[model samples]
Target: MLDQVHLPPLAQDFLAYLSLEKRYSPHTVQSYSLDLSQFFQYIQEQYGGIALDSVKAAHVQSWLALGLEGRKKAEDAHKRAQPPASAVTIRRKMSALKSFFKYALRKGAVKQSPMARVTGPKLPGRLPVFVDEHVMEKVETNQAGDDIPLFSDDFAGATRRMILRLLYHAGIRRAELTGLRDGSIDFSNGQMKVLGKGNKERIIPLGTAVLKELREYIAWRDAEFPGYAGGALLLTAHGKPVQAWDVYRTVRKALAQVTTLKKRSPHVLRHTFATHLMNNGADINAVKELLGHASLASTQVYTHNTIEKLRRVHEQAHPRG
Candidate 1:
């Protein structure tokens, strides 16, 4: 929720920049808009005559505190109304605030950024949970895909399997998976351009193993639906471009067979890809680039997985008397 107060000229501009220049995905943009809107509403109702753009660090801390100018304002109504948000939620809200202030700083809208030195609640160090290597190997195996049943041959069984393999092997985000166009793939070069968040584009290369499967799938697709779409690479059984839901369903069904992940979403595959790479000794920076992560901090979480692997190896190898 954004602040109820009228947005300053700069705040509106910042939102526009996020939408136009930054090209944040719709879901992300919508969340940002709501977070800001909620903040503004809280400021107006709680502080009465306070200027939202001039909010200070204390305001941010107070907003994040339980029962203080939050979603359920006034202690009387929200009394004993569930505990406040967890520290993790507080941390994320702070991050959103930090990003907003940074944007404001860039535009010179606010002389001093409120979140410049603000600290949010300390987040608990939750160990990264990853699939066991043996389990992952079993899960990633493309063999079981052969025994799967299909509702129709329109998307074709092969198409579904190829989709699963691409997401796992390439570690491409689901949106990036859908964004792929036919011409975007370079068979000769063995790479494809991935459009990630913030309109950032990067090239993802595939090993010969994945490239071979891709070629076979493409050939099959062409034979089934010759002269189908203009540039879109993946298509539904009816030769329509792959949608987000299609990718979700494909990944979900595949994971149901291989993984016990409760959510079994495509992003879990992305996490699995990063964790596996780190455990195998891939450089953190290199993994960051491969995933198109904007900040190294975001990628560093994978280090936890590597550390866990090292601990296991040390415990097994070292003999303690």
Candidate 2:
């Protein structure tokens, strides 16, 4: 999809800057590429392929308007129109254009950024969705009882359980979990190093229970795939490295058994991890470091969830009337 789009040389250079200088992940770079490609395609069709520096704020506004209101197909008069973009999608496209124009200005390609005059719609406040502590415990442990292990005694089961545990316990992003290496775990320090966004590494402390499970999982993995010398911590049944999609599918299937939440992904486990820590009175800064968040603002969303929980408790436990 990224290759299909014909981006100008300046756009390609901007993408290189994101990948090399900014150290953005491939997935993030691809998203920017897609957004830029779509914008350029619109510019080509609407304005007859104007130079980047000549593009005006009105062009940017028109492009955004088209996104908010679905564009009708030119060739098919009777065909249904494409659905309008959601607030989130429009915001992302706006961000992509802003970043690209900023980069172009720095490179002296553009005298000014059109996005300086543009504004995105304000998104409604939405709290992060996380599983309850009890629900997560049920998912981790046996449905019959808490003492027994939930996963089967097989290599596949062991890997799946490890994926779930690391996501929830370490509060690592899905990419960070997949990027983990065999050497990332330090048994002596009781902490594991996670490679987070922008290739930043953070150390997450592991509990004794998690350490015990890690040791068992390592033994099982080695035994199942003997003579395998891959550096990846997680592997498929064929001994190849596990991918991001594999992690998502594994988490989705496991969470489906316990949670009815529409979002049954590894991210839900990460959210659950942060929310549970906040609920249990963990400091915001400590949780921020544990989750490898770039700023306190990103970590503060969990506090709202904690406040909601406190409100519910007060309503049920306290009686004034």
Candidate 3:
């Protein structure tokens, strides 16, 4: 199944744009490469290892069939063993193929986008589970005490707590937080440079509480690691840059202490941040821009939350028995 075959030229060009023109990092480039590679492998198997340029509509249809197979395999894995892929993983692979074909069509490398005419398998939306404002406030209250044992202690405990609050308060993604450096924070203007999807940059505003915690955390960090702090904001005990999983584990552990929400990942907190803002009367379009969602359709899930709340209010108040 691992034969060596060149990708369609369009995919190659896209990779060039991703790295040279867009300046995507190595990890991002590799992810796109894996996505495209998996797509082509599926296509090859569907078409009996046909030539790269020979693919047609039937091949695209077959790829969707392969997605179905992947899901079936997932179900069997649950009963007897571990699934090699989740629904989310399959969806992502499909998205990668869709983007690749679209790029090929746009560049005239392919006659048309195969994904345009082919229908992808529909997936149900699984809304994120996040703690309510009351519980989040409880977390804040619990973590508000001064640095124990010494004013300038390790600060790892306090710093990690601030990271959780920052993610919950601001709807930025985990990559945005992990990619952050000390210089990314423009404290005077109270904004942060957040690198989001596709390596795009945006400025995010911070609340007074997050800002205060960050300033104190920075001071504490400097005190502990004297002459060691360079730029990265969140760091290990040894002042090294924080990784993506580090932030995820911190959020998971913090949420476990104060909330019963099952999904406690950083992105869940980001989703909670948006829905809560909308419930509290923030503009929907404003949330779209802040979360760096390319389309408002992607940001419209919060509207569902609003609808549910209104339905409950109507049922409780406007009863006509």
Q: lDDT by residue for model 3 over 1-321, one digit each (tens)?
A: 334363556677888888998898988777788878766766665555665446676776665565555445464555344324555666676676777777777776677666666665557776556568887776666642343221123477776776777787778788888888888888999988888888898889988778888899888888888887477888787678888888998888777776677788998888889988888998989999888999999988888887777888888888661
Name the runs in model 3 displaced over 4 angstroms. Answer: 1-122, 143-154
Candidate 1: clashing residue pairs, number: 17
Please give the lDDT score at residue 140 for candidate 3: 67
TM-score of candidate 3 to 2 decimals? 0.60
* Cα lDDT listed for each candidate: 0.75, 0.87, 0.75
Q: Which 10 successive residues of model 1 have the least lDDT summed?
A: 66-75
TM-score attained by model 1: 0.61
Give candidate 2 misplaced runs (Cα > 4 Å).
Answer: 1-121, 144-150
RMSD of each: 10.2, 10.8, 11.4
lDDT, candidate 2, 1-321, per-residue tens: 333445899999999999999999999999999999988888887788898899998998898888888868873576567788988999999999999999899999999998999988778679988999898878667452446456676788778888989999998889998889989999999999988888888899999999999988888788888897859998887788889999999889877777788998889999999999999999999999998888999999999999998899998888951
Best prediction by lDDT: 2
Instruction: Give the least accurate 10-residue stretch of model 2, judged by summed lDDT.
Output: 142-151
Between the candidate structures 1 and 3, which one is better when assessed by TM-score? 1
